[model samples]
Target chain A: MVQEDYILEAEKLYVSYNEIDIVRNVNFRIRKGEFLGIVGESGSGKTTLLRALMMLKRKNNDIKGNVRFQGRELIGLDEESLRRLRGMEISMIPQNAVTAMDGTKTISSLFHETICMHRDGKIRRRDSDKLASQIMEKMRLEDTGRILKAYPFELSGGMCQRVMIAAAMINNPKLMLGDEPTSALDVTSQLQVIQELELLKSNYQVSMIMISHNLGVISRIADTIAIMYGGRFVEYGSHEDIIRHAVHPYTKALLAAVPDADGKISKGLPGLPPTFEKEMKGCPFASRCEYCIPRCRKELPEDVAISLTHRVQCFRTKELQDDIA
Target chain B: MTLLKVENLTKRFKKNGETVTAVNEISFSVEAGECLGIVGESGCGKSTAANLISRLQREDEGNIFFEGRKINGGFRLKPVGRELQMIFQNPQDSFDPRDTVLQGIMQGALSYKVYSNRELKEKALDLFSYVGLKPEYQNKKTSELSGGECQRAAVARALICEPKLLICDEATSALDVLVQAQLIDLLKKLKNDKKMAMIFITHDLPLAAAFCDRIAVMHKGRIIEIGEARKVLKSPEQEETKKLIQAVLPVR
Candidate 1:
């Protein structure tokens, strides 16, 4: 495939907060209209990785990355230049719709402001009304007139999330970044959000990088899944590789921890994730990894390619696979 | 023996000048040392029903019989504090921000005046270990602990009173999947070793099906489905329950 075929590519991406490295040497290539789901426990830096991809700013944040979006380098871009890409070329949906949205503003004005930001000028209220309702219809949020007039507090959390999705889609960006977009929702609303995302995939051909702690949701929706442990992708593979042919012990343990759809929970991983209080040297999962050998604690293994799309960062990958097979 | 029995339990709140029947005449009985899971969405009256049973909120109309003694609106005459305890969903926020988890638990236990200072400390330490926390965490503030650890602390706090009937309202909802699994294992062990009855309330249908002996699903302030976990999973009676079961997409 040509280089242009890839929508976004990352090379040796590293991010640290206040001199403490959180994301390290992450590399991946996402093709057009393909979504990658990143899963991890809290403090695993999944959210940090998403923000670094978009160059979102925070106190004492540092990013050293080579990100190619449509073959254009994005790491060194000026703020003004990056602003053009955001919400137009790349959109982000936040974790909490209720908190992310301004409670004082009406939904109509919120949409109007989002449009006005990327368009570089003021937009007519009538045009915002038309555009907001049109995309809201696509998102399956009926009663547009009422919803448009109501504040964020008035609408339910699910409705606010769908409205946020609609606002993100207003410019028809090529890619979307979501941070647990459906985590705060109930099952019904979560299914609805999934349906909306599926619609976007089919209708608009939008690619996404979504962060979720839910294994079930990620496995169901994501084309390629990346399992993050202690700020790095311990295992990045296709659904078949990670779920069926899992090589990393942490990935396997994460799967075992979740109760199945029929509600049968198996043996659990005993210890908690590494707090990273000591000097970083070996695999972050070494503390809790049941099959951890002496070498796993001494050194961090390279990301070994088990297949064309699957990568496992563990010294015992082959042995684990052989045992499973 | 029947540990708890609710007959015609109802709670209504006037929200925005409109009367909302949060829990509408829901009735169920829990046996001693058995887990009863109540599954529902937000505003489905599961939490309200729990509050009514735990005496956190007064029921508009109902009869709550605790161990065959009617104790609703009459909790003062027949105090069930030592026997009945409830844990909320957000244990982190439920705790006092300034106090350590050990202090909070100790204070709650102190309300009963059952144990002396030295025995209370020992029992708190014992309960802390029982809930799967290390001894050092006893002095740590609630803010320093993770969500799962804080919830375990909440469990320790609740168990300090030695409540035979424990009500956990969405206790594991805020944690990660792996953490939720660990907490589930802890709860199962507690049920057996401590001989405790639990009203495990959550919105997770499959979890309830797996964890509880009997499952009661509430919808729109009503009990839509109530039966054995296996029976409910095999053949659900209500459309709402069926939708909930279907809503859980299996992880491949």
Candidate 2:
């Protein structure tokens, strides 16, 4: 696809804090109205990538490489220009809605802020109120008036999450970034939230980059899947390609970890992920990988293209393929 | 025979002068050596019930019986507290920062005067091993361990008390899927070795179904349904339970 066909693209991006590279040489692209899922464990730099995209990281943090939106480099954008782009061109629905939103502010006021900011200070109270109600209605939120009047603390977690989504999508941004959107919710509420996201993606024609640890959620919604580990993408491809034929050991471990509906427990991977402070000389997963070779422990694996779309960073990719064959 | 029975257990907290019934007249029972799972959403009173059983919180009005003796009927039962212990969700907060894993477990054993100092150390090391932690981890502080290690330490502390009942309140919820599977395996091993009865409280129905012999489904502080884990989860009798089951994505 041409560059213009993609709404967002990250090319060889590197993000670091205090000179420590947290996200190393990441690359991905999100097409128009496509849902991309980034799955990884905690401290895997998934959040860091999203923060970099939103420009929400600390000012002193060093960001290297290119992040383009509609072919425009976003790394050098000024605060004013970035602010103008936010909620109009792109918006983020943060995790932990209870803390992300102001506890004292009503849901309606939060929606008003987004509308006002995105409209370049042109939104009126009457128009904002109508828009908020319409959006809330689209979300199928109950008692819209009461919800608008109630503060974040007054609503349930599920309700607060919906309100956050409404606020984020009120201006109808072209792309939406969700950071562990359903992780904080219960199973039932998680399904509802995922359904709402599907609805928004379809109705609003908005592309999404959903970051989650649950592969099950990714399987349900994501068109593309990127498995991140130790600040790098170990595998990236279509959902079918990655799920059916995961080339990376970390991705295989993740898939095995999920309990089947029959309640049969699978063998879990042993050992913990290496700490970020430790310098990785080879494959980050080599220590815990069952198929680790001596070469895997000493040499970093390069990203090897397997097919037109599938790619993986593993020395044993061919061996795994042959074993499957 | 019922190993433990909860009769109309209720707890209320006054927040801003409004009485919120956290546990609303919920009742359930567990057989000896049975693992009973309590599944619900947050603010649905599963944790409250666990706390009540562990004596971490006193219920407003209810009766909890263990071994045919009443334990939650307004009468003080310090002995019952010794027979039950709780494992919280956040393992780091459950332990003191300055305390090592051995120190934490030894403290639990020492509280009931179960073992001498040297014996406690040995027991702590053994507990660590039982939970799949290395003996070297016994001297490590909470900060030195990962989330899964910290949870193993928490389990060691709870088990060191040698309680007849263990209450795991979302003990594996904060863990990654792989770590969660390991912890569940550890719990299953411990249950088989000790034949210990447990109350596994969580919001994940599938997890509960996997770990518990029976499950109690809670909604709005009420025990909406209770039965064998497979039956209750597979063919829930209550509307709320059915909705919860349907909401979960079917695992492939």
Candidate 3:
């Protein structure tokens, strides 16, 4: 693809908090209308990396990287420009709907505030209500009157999640960031929310970066998948490449741990993911990897490419695949 | 032999000045050493049923028989002791924060007054190893352990008294995939080794298919379908069950 065709790009990005690097030396790019999924265990720094991409700041955090959104650097942009770009061009759906929204405010009040803030006097109060109702309908949420009058606490988790998605789509932003959007919901509600997200992507051409811990959830929606471990991506490729031709030991272990839809109980991966508290010299996953060697414990492996769209950072990717097969 | 029998079990609650039927006249039975799964979405009254069966909640109208004798609410005045035990989704919140692993587990055996302190400690250690926890974990507080480790500890605690029926109420829902798999394997092993019957409640259809010998599909506080796991999965008659089966991700 051409450079101008890319909607977002990251070059050698690193994020640190309290002098400990949480995201290190990462490079990424997403084409127009592309959906990228990042999968990792808890504390793998995927959430931190997602926040850094949007330039969301935290206390005692330091970020160094080149983040380009539509050919403009986002790292050092002024607050006023960022405010204009946030809801208009880029938006986020937070991790949990229960805590993300205010409990005291009604759904209609929140929607009115958002529409007025984004449009800045261009849309009248009556039109804003009409627009909000239309977006809710597009999200497949019936009973608009009942939903609008209800508070966040009155709605179920799934309804609250759909409301969050509707709020995110009111402006029709080009990019949407979802952090564990379906984790809190049950199976049926999860399917509904995922289908709604897929609809948003297809009908509105909204590109997305979805962060999740389950590969099953990611595989259903993502076009491209990245397996993150410790503080970096262990493998990056197309969804097919990552699912069928996974090379990294961590990636292979993750795939083997998920229960199948056909009711097959998978042989689980042994041991827990390591906690990265300090700077490390070698690969962080060496302790749990079954195929780890002396060299793996002594030095970090470089990214080895198997195809144009597939790459893995492992010392013995080929041998690991052979063993698993 | 039938270990537990419930006939016309019903529970109702008042919400916003309206009487909602949380569980509406459900009937089921469990055979000795058999696992029965109750699969449903939220507000389907699966948890309420479990609570009523375990005597954690009172049913408005129902008949519960254990060992061919009618029993009232469990664990009170009946001296059921460890005969019935329940495991919840979040074990961390259920535990006392100040208690150590050994203390938490011993509470089960201590309630019966059947085992000496030394015997309980020995049994607790054996259970710790059986559930895949190390010996050192027995001394740590609940907050010090990870979510998976705490769940494993909860299982060990639940089995320490050697219950006849284990009720797991969405016990693995809060865990990640890897931990969920491990916990299921552990539960399967325990069921076979101890010959214990179980009432497993969950929202995941595939998981119920894999874990239970028989499955019951609940919707709107009613059991719409009940049969062998394979039979129900192969030919689901209820629209709710079909929708749930379709929602599951296709396993590669």
Candidate that scores best on lDDT: 1
Instruction: Give one digit per residue, the lDDT tens place, for model 3 in A161-205.
Output: 999899988988889999999888898989999999988988899
Q: On TM-score, who's better, 1 or 2?
A: 1
Q: Give the clash total for candidate 3.
A: 0
**lDDT-based ranking:** 1, 3, 2
Candidate 3 vs. true structure, TM-score:
0.94
DockQ of 3: 0.57
| iRMSD (1 decimal) for each model | 1.4, 1.7, 1.7
Which one wins on DockQ? 1
Model 3 Cα displacement at A196 (Å)?
0.5
Q: What global local distance difference test value does model 1 have?
A: 0.88
Q: lDDT by residue for model 1 over A64-168, one digit each (tens)?
A: 979989998998899999999999999999989989999889999999999999987888999999999999998778899999999999988888898899999
Candidate 2 displacement at residue B102 in angstroms: 3.8
TM-score of chain A taken by itself, candidate 2:
0.97
- Candidate 3 chain A weakest lDDT stretch, 10 residues: A116-125
Q: Over 4 Å off in model 3, which ranges? A: A121-124, A320-325, B73-78, B116-118
CAPRI class of candidate 2: medium
- Pairs clashing within candidate 1: none
What's model 2's lDDT at B42?
A: 81
Tens-digit lDDT string for candidate 2 (B45-68) = 888888888777889988888989
List clash counts for every candidate, in order: 0, 0, 0
